[model samples]
Target chain A: MSMGRRLPVYLLLDTSGSMSGEPIEAVRQGIKALLSDLMSEPTARETVYLSVITFSSSAQQIVPLTELMSFQEPSLDANGSTAFGDALKVLEQCMDREVVKATSTTQKGDWKPLVFIMTDGQPTDSWESVADHIKQKKLGNVIACAAGPGADENMLKKVTELVVKLNSLQPEALKAFFKWVSDSIKTTSQSVAQVAADTPIGLPKPDPNNMIIVL
Target chain B: MNTEKATLKDGRTIEFVHDQPRSGTMKEVYFTPDRKSVVCFYKDPCAGSDANRLQRLQMILGAYNPTLPQSHGGAAQNDIEADYYRKLFCWPTGIVVQPRFGLVTPAYPSNFFFPTGPVWLKGEEKNGMWFIGPKNRKWFEKNQPSELGSLIQHFSLCLQIARAVARLHNAGLAHSDLSHNNVLIDPSKGMSIIIDIDSLVVEGLFPPDVLGTKGYIAPEVLSTIQLDLKDPKRKNPNARTDQHALAAFFYWYLLGRHPLDGRRIPPGNTAEEQDLLAFGSQAIFCEHPSDSSNRPEEKQYVPCSALGPLLYDLFIRAFVKSLHSPSDRPTALEWVRGFVKTWDLLIPCSNSSCLHKWFVFHNSTDIRCPFCGTRFKGTIPFLKLRAESRPGQWAMDGQLAVYNQLPIFKWHIYSRVFPSPETDRTRQAYCVFHEGKWFLVNEKLTSLTSPGGNRVPPGQAVELKDGAQIRFSQEHNGRIAEVQMIRS
Candidate 1:
């Protein structure tokens, strides 16, 4: 479709064994609510293109980057271990294939992609190499959320500077985090629409009582 | 921190609650204790020039109270004028000192901004630009049709914006950053409020601090981008640039498309370079008269031609003929006149499903809804009014679609002044189009007469026919309008 710049938002969710019951259900409902909320905003509806990459024993491209109007919330189920390394690889490949790059010609590139990764525990796989590789490519702003007590903040910090730790695995806290994510997306989309800038937007202050910045 | 107090230069103490302060690009805004006003504290301290500009602006605003008649004057008229100016602007009410440099302005009404909903659990609203985007506008039209109002009402809203800008320009001030983002519009009531008064450019005294919002900035300003800030050749936002922004805004509001944005992406290595070429020195109107490369895709928009020849001509002057010439661009006053004329020419569509219920009376042989392509079946009545321009000469001053209870403004009947509640009563006359015939009722105290010397007093009506001539008032050089009823 002929349109203005697109804001590609990637949800790198961790459907690991630790996030099996209430946490997984919350993630599912949270993703649904986030999609619905983003779709409601005119700027988000116009510029945001959503994609889902769930990582557990291995990474899976549950949903490719698609416009919000046509995006469907994929059914996510928890399994095996958190393979962060494999997830990083898949994310890098996705960015290479899906994200349009600006050239010295007629084809204009998309806005910088915003990536949100949520995980409840440490990565079972060696993710540092892949993480370093993607970081070298400098593919947009990446926000990593270490959900629940067992999540590794130190390890996630290596992947992105914007790392937040959720104190509890309660459904309410998870919902609030997702709501913040959606709000951030809304802000980014609006900023891009206003000036077509590729810079990172100032995020809303996280709930200090429940969510704490690690880096 | 719960509450903080600061004193203005006039010794008026104002209290602000620090519980929830909203941070914008340049300043942090906090609501006053009473919530009727907002105090904006700049993040960075104002430079000497900026401080001087603010002081000068305060003086200008203080001396801007509109005059009122003695009989209708008093605190009530004062309140009316106060409300009028307030509605037109979010003028800074006071200046702040102490912890930081700040300006205070009245809090916007709840409806002035779009509700943020669950995004900002604490109530915050997005500015008007949120609604003007193509996709958002489409969503609003589809989901909240009533809020979009009719096309005529949209034209009126455009007129209000132009009038507000004209008022500011007349006061020797230019809204340096005039764009969709700085203006708040309530489409339902056809009302608009221009915000960011603090950044107004006062010519030699205050010079514009910022360039302008992207896309709305003039091509001339864009051409000077490579120049150093201190370079004499570098252009700044001024009255002429504001005119460009106004034209851009009008085009977007009426057509739901950017005047310069087109399918041809300028060759560049970066998005910034592309934008610079697309909206700057090499800017081209998508609907340029000679250039077909950038014309909007068919079926997606109501063609500019559908807006009627009068408005279409103005759009041409705004976007095509004057694209590069700042002085050649139509002024805000001209836009107001064009919009008023277009508003007068609107005819309601027979198609209930028509997105815009009204379309301009193109005065064509085949009358059809421009939006829905539905044919207008009945004989549409078009009234062309000719008023005396000189002692023995007459000129066509007004034309209107004769719809049921359509109001005829004082400006239509009087050649001297335009209509406003403060100037003239709401309307001078109203037309009733019923059952193939038309009747015009005199609503004002001024006498309405036919060419046959038959006077129709107030509360009385007169039959309107083809080639009818009516005398609108008894005052000196009273308007004599000749009506030409065109049946389509």
Candidate 2:
């Protein structure tokens, strides 16, 4: 009754310097597009809370648990090594801190939350523990998207049940991919918008080839 | 707090959470940053004959006012949270208060499946605001609440702000800024509530500026937001805007998404899709015409014969006057009658405007043509859109088929093909189903929809199953192409 109502939208971004150019700019464009798109729905406005984590030198909670109305695009300044493990750990922690919490009110309930994680490189640092943690929740099933010029599709596949590789390193390609990602989210959320919640939902399936599944 | 695990039966350790509104004990359940839900112990009032508790609970939550936002825009979620906080501490009697927003505390008899009502203020944008949902119900497996009973137990901890809105409306108010994210459904509860209530206003008058988010904004308010928002006196919001928003609300309720397909990105090249939505029979304010070519001078705006008539009068209101005189539109109560009838008809649409408003395939049906933005035109007797894209172009070829955008089977006909001048392109068409039934229609004619039109197709029956069995062929000479239904 007294708890806050919000929609958890997680963005797992890659901040590798290779992405310092247009890739980062495009991602920013895609994110702004996502927020702008969601602004149309009353439900998405009050319920969709967003969090962004960039993994460059290390995973940083660039934008903490915020809502569409409040969310600002995180600057993807490229530097340092790609610490995939650190990114995932930080992302999972952000999700935990922002999405789930212990309280004296909930008798018990699970909000089937959706997450979209993207990356462009292999884990330069050890990501086994974080990978293991994410894999368990069927984290792979949470509408995860992976892209990059030198990204490890194998590693990304492990992170997401549905993995895709960008055909080109063009940041436009990344933006296009995110746009499609936005479309798929738009479609799934639209369909789910109808029936009451708790309806068993199949994970989102984006068009392959353009951004085919590597997993 | 082990927030990541769910309850399972085998060694697989399948973590699970049972969302019940009853009070009990469990362990570490995680909630979102907004603090709307928690994993605690609760009871099940639904286990018995206490059906009245659900209604009572709504009344209990409904008792609070302050739902109104202190300003325009969706960023005022804190207005709602602050209200929740204030009510929990100040409300009386059976309305015993709690500390730190006592609504979801384990001390009350709850009929909720999950703790989804309250939303915390996180951040804001030029658009609107947002709240968060419970991470998982697994935390409640150990400890739960008491005062809130168990009715909607298996649902998620998401808020359906409609109930709150409905309460406000019932109390004579309209939530000015209704957008995609303002609502969150506790699917488990089978109910909805409204948030950001301070901005609510009573029915009868149209607000100067459309307060809801952009895409969800109604046509009547379009001119204002697109123009007048710059002028303070131009802001005109009323209960009617709320009525106009009802359709979009319904779309979001059923889809867990937004309604408009929006424009697809070009050749999958960029992130931005077509951002404009075409409305108005003609041009914006400056070029609005008195004798708008799209306006059917033959049609008279007869007062709604029956409010229950689907899009009858409003079709004229939104489309007809949409160009030259948007201010002449019908009232929210009037639209309500039409929509109520729509709900009763059982036809559902993912379209933000006509979500449940079953459109009829009758000549007299009035509609808001997306392309030309006209209303109250004589609809065609037989016409439907088909999906066809060739080397250089795309055309929504007319066929006697009810094209749907199902999740697994998505299609967007090249042209919407409504009568126009409002462009009017004509051609004979046929829809051939795999079952071998073929119905002939015009390219821009035919109302396959009508009163009960959703229940039964007016043309010849063509039962087509999903798969390769469905194929469409247009006429060789550019006439309505011949339709062929072959069973593989």
Candidate 3:
């Protein structure tokens, strides 16, 4: 039997000081729920490879790209300043190293990765240059979510055009965000991610009360 | 733990779970009190506001519905016929008009779900993807081998899907979104059921709401996917496209790989662009006779030819000839007929430990199991069935590779009856090897005549020897069977 190409998904979370206590616990729960949900789906489990990169004082790739069956929930903690710029740099490195590209010799390659960035506070580091490079290069379908009021939508907008916002860092809102992420990944696996290379992803509509899409 | 009431357009009331319901792409699903049925409400507020959707649902539950008898304004002729179709489809039963645009559908049969397994797998619906896709199949092949059924069982799964699609096409309807997500299969018992009936495409009236799933989408439809919905060049889902999906499903079920998902990479800088070209405009069959560039990279694979000549011809017609030409594609009825004929050619493998316990007996001279490469070492009997085409001329109709207790049915004895929903399925006779000699005992045939022209009555048998012939029936369109014994 021919094994299929992988659909790599990278989750970048902000473990800044503001995202402590209840907010951090909710993020842990969300990761747990997302893993179980993706594992149960046959197509998602077959092609979806997941990784996690967290940034507090500095960014670190907590989990390497792994299939759903073998993926473990990484231990998360909240402290220090938000190094959003460092996180983006780490994500770029991991994607370049892990994502496979189709060439003349190799017929099969990984799908363009789906990247989700969740942050509740502003970056305390210089991030403008890396953000412009990532956006101009069109690395992947990067969806940046401005979590809570402390997060600036415009600053995150500089990173990717596809942006959504959560009104609060409450556990319920974070859970809903993760649920939506799972649904989006499921839809991509089950359908053509985008009709063309540059079109917006055909994602399922989210709950209006908890989440808002910044068009 | 709250409950709510929903009123249907027909003045019936149903209660459902009131809390945050489980939602799908387009609908929010709620379970009824006893869990016998589910009430699904369309998420878009405009869906129920429009009258067209109401009319479409009415048509689906009424004249076009196969799960209901004609007396109830459905397509089926009688109760028994309707009963048979009920097992094949989870047809919507009612329309919910009060709460929102919704449908009431029966819960899937229990067998469509995994009864017990790992916590992640238990109680989950047996979507066709779980059993057919390469990665998931690998998991089953390693951890739970019982879920992966034998080769014959997979064939029967394809046959049932063909039969179900034939019924829909017979009524001039098409399941626009026919994919693994909408079709559930239980390979253990050789059963399949099609869900999501509300998305059916009705000609000149209701258009399809969805384009279709990724891998199952027809080439023409995907090629024109970027076109505007109202554009004339945009090809929508129809019966022909459904034929493409039906064939793809059959290929996946039998071969354990996709037919068109090959190694040929198209020109595109991004994955999405490459996919659009590879699966749409530049689609190529992996097993194309002349084009070997798109061949699967797997070191070992069971070629489509392993399924035998009858099915191989259909596969070629489906993937190679009509991949881009929708009109030239093999119809669902054609697939049904092909599988019915192929069913007679099936024989159990001699290898006791073979993963595929049954295989098509393609060649008697080179009797071998394609899966395990085991050759048979004994005498085998074959009954070549013929039908009278002229006054005294008998034409070759089909051949049955005989095995112990292989029962013959009405379709075998009578030439007019092709196995369908309304066909009589009673067994007419059976074959058995007694004392090292093959005998086809007469069980229900009233006019079973031996090669010597003597009537072999019920409870009597005729020895199937070399050059022996038997007339299955003396009535109009009766078939004659010529026995050939081959020793390997």
Best by DockQ: 3
Candidate 2 lDDT tens digits, A111-139:
33466777766678998777877877643
Error of 3 at A190 (Å): 1.5
Index of the highest-TM-score prediction: 3
Calculate each model's fnat, 2 decimals: 0.25, 0.00, 0.51
lDDT of each: 0.76, 0.40, 0.88
Q: What's the TM for model 1?
A: 0.82
Runs off by more than 4 Å, candidate 3: A1-3, A193-195
lDDT of 1 by residue, B1-488 (tens): 49998777667889999875765656789998888999888766653246576666565446542222223321114655555656777777777775677778888777765543334211434445446676667766666666676787778778888888887787677888877668877777777888887777878877777778755788888777677878998888999899999988888777777777776677665455566677777788888878877766444767777888767887788888887888888888888888877778788898987877888877767888887888887655566666667767767777777778888777777777774435655777888876767888888846788778988888988877777777777665567766666655
Model 3 clash number: 0
Error of 3 at A154 (Å): 2.1
- Segments in model 2 whose C-alpha atoms lie over 4 Å from true places: A1-4, A101-110, A138-141, A188-190, A193-200, A203-209, B1-488
How big is the positional error of residue B88 in model 3, measured in Å on the Cα after superposition?
0.9
Q: Which stretches of candidate 1 lie over 4 Å from their true place?
A: A1-3, A13-41, A54-57, A68-82, A100-109, A116-215, B1-9, B15-35, B40-81, B98-101, B113-130, B207-211, B221-228, B231-233, B269-273
Better of 2 and 3 by DockQ: 3
